[model samples]
Target: MTAGLPEPAGFPDCPVCAYVLTGTARLCSDCAGRTLQPVVDPHCPVCSQAVAPGGQCGNRLCTLPLQQRGFSRVDAVAVYSGALKDKIHKLKYEGRRGWAMIFGRLLVGWMESHPERMRGVDYVVGNPTHPTRQPIQHIEAIMDAAYTEDVTHVLPLSPPGAHRLVKTTETPRSANKNLDDKRTAAAEHAAALTWTGDTSDIRDATILLVDDVLTSGSQLQHVARRLRASGAADVRGLVLARVPWSG
Candidate 1:
């Protein structure tokens, strides 16, 4: 067996749980069973969230109209819970940098499942980060996904060291309290950042925004609004997980 290659039918190590494996395993049987959870059954097609049965967003945590809003098209890789959440936690707070690639690959796999939507997507970007943070993990993952040859939505890398979006918020937010509180906090925190990049390529191009999680979507919304202002034709969100919130 090769040094790093998976042995015969060996599965890759699960990104969430440190499941022990003999060879190059991406996901073990237990981790492979994890999947995206549908928060909204009859979700709005645009935002892709479960809305009130009557078409309004009944989620009390969100005060935006019960109608469709934000990002012309949005999709999540998995529901923000269970093993997926565990993996996301480690990726962000823990030093598990490799999880970024794992999540990025998951996003690519999700895109491959829905190839029709891949058309016209010109750029792939993640939310802006504070200059204080040393390295951005999810960005690295997106870069990896762009290079993976087997994926259907095989995207390419953007400019290296060209992190145009930078977070300006000095203090961290506390939306972890409740859903309603989260919406307000997320929106405020999201506004603290600005985009710093060349507008030449973004104009009239479809941009795929990548992120580890989608809580209130304030970050993505703020960025999309900014992108549209910069002449971007469309903005789509590709998140690793979506937290389920209720009234």
Candidate 2:
């Protein structure tokens, strides 16, 4: 939604290898192929940490905050690296809305592969952006493709809604900040989020939180926390890319 990026040149091609595609293309069907590599495979279901394949972490120490808060699990599509990062940047900042189709396709593929994982999803929600910024239309478009009319919802944490997720206390722009700085900003942002949804409604329903990118897992973590606090029975995160934390 940022300005001066142009309309995205009619959706974007694979940044790595230029391959024209329809709205249904998940990956470069011509050059890179249709399927995409999994992001968090062989990860601890609780903490999403890389572990032995089919391995489970029984100990509480390895549990992620979301799991401890009573959510089931978190699943991402692809690692937030390589061409994925470039595509996400284009979709988010450059107004390349066409890339959203790829993201949606990936989500649908993930859901199909792990049908049980998304079994009882009652609503599809996206990570709320600042009021000044446009809603993540990409996610909505993707969700429309993913769920159709059976499940359609958009939960905003900002204006037009009584609930306020995280508020921006500092003028520090996340994209411009270093990793540590981003983490700090995210923590501050989390503290400012206020829950205004009904505890019982959120508690028993299954909620899927969508975001464009996942870096440091701070934003999702905080949002998950607030949702759980509001009584969300299960909260899962879906992101186009998962930027690994080098630290």
lDDT of 2: 0.54
| Candidate lDDT values, in order | 0.58, 0.54
- lDDT tens per residue, model 2, 1-247: 2155332222234432333343223232212223344555666664454555676644343355545444455566666666767777776767676666556555654554555777787655666545445434454454544443122222221222332232433334577788678767665665665544445667667777777776546666767767777767777777766556442
Point out where model 2 deviates above 4 Å.
1-35, 47-71, 134-172, 176-184, 187-200, 245-247
**Which portions of model 1 miss their true places by more than 4 Å?**
1-40, 51-55, 59-70, 134-153, 159-174, 177-197
Residue-wise C-alpha lDDT for candidate 1, range 1-247, written one tens digit per residue: 3347443332124433333322112333223424445445777565556666776754332454422234675677656877678767776666576665555556655565567777778877667556465444455444454345233334533544555555676535553567566556556656775656666777788888777777666656656776777777887887767777665
In model 1, the clashing pairs are 11-25, 12-25, 12-26, 12-27, 13-25, 13-26, 37-79, 40-50, 56-66, 57-66
Q: Once model 1 is optimally superposed onto the true structure by TM-score, how far is the C-alpha of residue 48 displaced, in angstroms?
A: 2.5
Q: How many steric clashes between backbone atoms does each model show?
A: 10, 5
Question: How close is every model to the real structure, measured as TM-score?
Answer: 0.70, 0.64
List pairs with backbone clashes in candidate 2.
Answer: 80-242, 165-193, 202-232, 203-231, 203-233
